[model samples]
Target: MTLQTSLDDDAAWQAVLARDRHFDGRFVTGVLSTGIYCRPSCPARHPARANVRFFVDGAAARAAGLRACRRCLPDDVARDERAVLDAIAAIRGSDEPLALAALATQSGYSPAHFQRLFTRNTGLSPAAYARALRSERAHTALSAADRVTDAVYDAGYSGPSRFYAAMKGRTGMEPSVWRRGGEGMTIHWAVMPCSLGDLLVAVTAKGVCRLSFNETAADLAKRFPNATLHAATAGTSDMFNRALAGVEAPATAAQVPIDVRGTAFQELVWKALSAIPPGETRSYAQIAASIGRPKAVRAVGSACGANQVAVLIPCHRAMRTDGTLGGYAYGLDIKSALLDKERKA
Candidate 1:
């Protein structure tokens, strides 16, 4: 691509090299050799640096006497977006998981290609997305229904057995336990100090169930009234240490397993938040778009607010669309400090 004027030209070039879809629509890439411009994330072969330029937008590129490329159609994001939305609707409306090949064919692309496109845009594989839909539906139903059997059946499960089998990992606990708010589970929690104040890490057998700031055993007691809460013993296990590592140094910390609950959309928002690197941030709209629900920007903010575990999920990495840090549950001061810490790391 030919060089062009930009305040952060080097950063734009890096985004091009990475094919960073996050930069799509922010600018258009103009190729002098081909005399056509494309989106920054165009899968088309990169032109030589001397042959390319960047424009503020597609109109700017067109004004510069460049046409749009066909492959990555820099101006036709809506077409691919429609295909993605249609597929998502189908997935949510289905009682059973749609086959990848079938969904791809319906979207007018090969299965392999469609899989990549779908995942790249939505940050989830088709099957995984379907599973999330199923789990979410089941959970919603369970919350309102008196009987688990009826709830599962109503949620489109063939039987209670199948529902349990399918929701083995998606849920924080068994259907009954979850519905009863940890009726039969045991949670151990400990309060410790960190760069932030008063870190509370609660764990179950599976993993950390909750992590937050300025919480005590009494706080844990209130949150899990139905469960048994124990203070950490003198010999806290390696799992507890791992959870602390996640809180103290999340950027390089090993993957810390979390056994927590969330709604379907919240789970998607959380997954997108986790995908963000330590030093980088994503706008709430960007997170919503990554999950193929760009219109749910406000809901994304709600999900961030609803986060039970802090730092590990990195809700602080999300900001308002205008690049300002939005509200945080703890406080803005803590959030700003966490961002600064990560960036420095």
Candidate 2:
């Protein structure tokens, strides 16, 4: 199938300038002067704009007589992303964790080589992925099982203690609270002015469940629709203030707890966003590729749009494949200012 994206040459050029990884497989850059093609995220010194021609894929670049870039290895990267995706599917579908040797055999890669490739592509080792899968199953089971013990067993854990430990480590909440959708939850929220604009933060006992810009308590009510919402008391907890400060100065945002929720793929996308260093940026394509779903660029964008935590999760770091700013839930101006601040810091 042909590699495709909506980006035009001018947009693609911007991605090249930013070394945006999201556009890596969406398009290739053919340098007229060097007769070589590279992925958009190539770290080599960029060629002059006039000397670069964009192609939908390396085949097109090769047809134009350009040799593939040794640095980016675009084709190999795509294949690796696809292979990791297949491995993830197998892991998620299996009742038990597949052995590393078995997974390597299925992917036609040597054990050592496959482990490295899988980690490089997904930012997760196979074992880590399996653990995450079990955690997700346990969380789902908790929501429907008649008893916590039943849920633990149903999620494939041999022991309830293992499930309890994992849940505490991941969510820092009681299983009953998680399963009941924030029942008996007291969420303190306040809207405050900041560099970006109006910042709204809602915190559960577990962590920050919602942090957004230009939204109101009414919006929060709609989001939780069920949980109690209160203005920050005369003196909120230090953790609440730290979360607020994190939004005000994202570059220095402390790693406070977060209770944000989403589907597995959405969570993966958010995790990738949070890992982007301050002042750095990535395209949706790069995020999708990082999650081993290169073809899910559009889905990645949707996940970004659905993000509720704002600067804490750093959703603003996600940009257009062309390095241009894309949509933001608040506004483009706010997004631009946020990026500028991070870059200056």
Candidate 3:
């Protein structure tokens, strides 16, 4: 795909400041002042934004009369992302769980460093990623299988007891019920037009769980295909209406309660995001420091991206250290509008 198709200049600039590895190999940053091109996540000092240019690839950068920065070596796209990708490839490629030491050795880094590197890039430590992967595999197996025992074994769990215990926390339901795709519970959802766009609010007996934009009732049903989904009843409308109002005016959205799910670290990052007062913002680096994992800035970004509850969780409040608006799930136009609304409020 073309560079413009992959990411616009504004989005690419965010990657440059964050040193976001996801954008590595997708584009090269040409520093006009230095006459050099570098990887998006190059650690070298950043040139002035006006002096920076983006090229589709190394050839384009060279054609523009720029040499690659010796430090980041933009010409070698594969190696720029090799360290983290190698670790990820090894973990995903293996059926059985690979130990930290083994993965570290394969990546040519010491165990501790490898763990940090892996977590910084993927947002979860190696072990945590393994657990999540296992849980996902189990969930998929459960969804596709007719029998609970079949899923349990297929998920790689040694026994039913362990599998049920692990799945309980992940699905917040019994193994049998979860395997049935939340068959026992009723999910009420509504798609209401708000200032942003079509806002979909879905809730269970617990609380408001999902608040998404540009989605239809069908989208919500697909999220929990096993659950009995219906339009919001009068009893449930008030709670969700308030949430919709919150989306219209974020400064007033706080008191609305939400029931959401995420990993422990993601919860921490979400909490930090929620604490960012209506009009203000925080950098990904700052959020990482607040969570006591100062180096997990990328992971913090991942948590923001993974946020299911949009305005209530306030992922848009997080930005890059350079004070530019970073990536946003719902489009930067919406992100900018939300921030603008909050600041005015």
Please provide TM-scores, in order, for all candidate models, with all chains considered together. 0.88, 0.80, 0.58
Cα RMSDs, all models = 3.6, 3.7, 8.7
- In order, candidate lDDTs are 0.82, 0.81, 0.79
Please name the candidate that would achieve the greatest TM-score relative to the true structure.
1
Per-residue lDDT over 8-84 for candidate 3, one digit per residue giving the tens place of the 0 to 100 score: 78978987997865466668998889899999989998889999888888888888898988997777655424766
Range of the 10 consecutive residues with the lowest summed lDDT in candidate 2: 1-10
Lowest-scoring 10 consecutive residues by lDDT in candidate 3? 1-10
- Given candidate 1, what's the lDDT at residue 145? 93
311 Cα displacement, candidate 3 (Å): 5.5
Which candidate, 1 or 2, has the higher lDDT? 1
Cα lDDT of model 1 by residue, 1-345, tens digit: 233433256767777897878777667888989899988899988889888888887788888899999998888665566677889999988878799989988889889988987887777888888877888888888889998888998888888888999887766578977888779888888888887888899888878888999978888888889998888875556777887777678764438888877877888888888888887888887788787887898999999998888988899999986568989999999999989888888
Give the total clashing residue pairs for model 1: 5
Strongest candidate by lDDT? 1
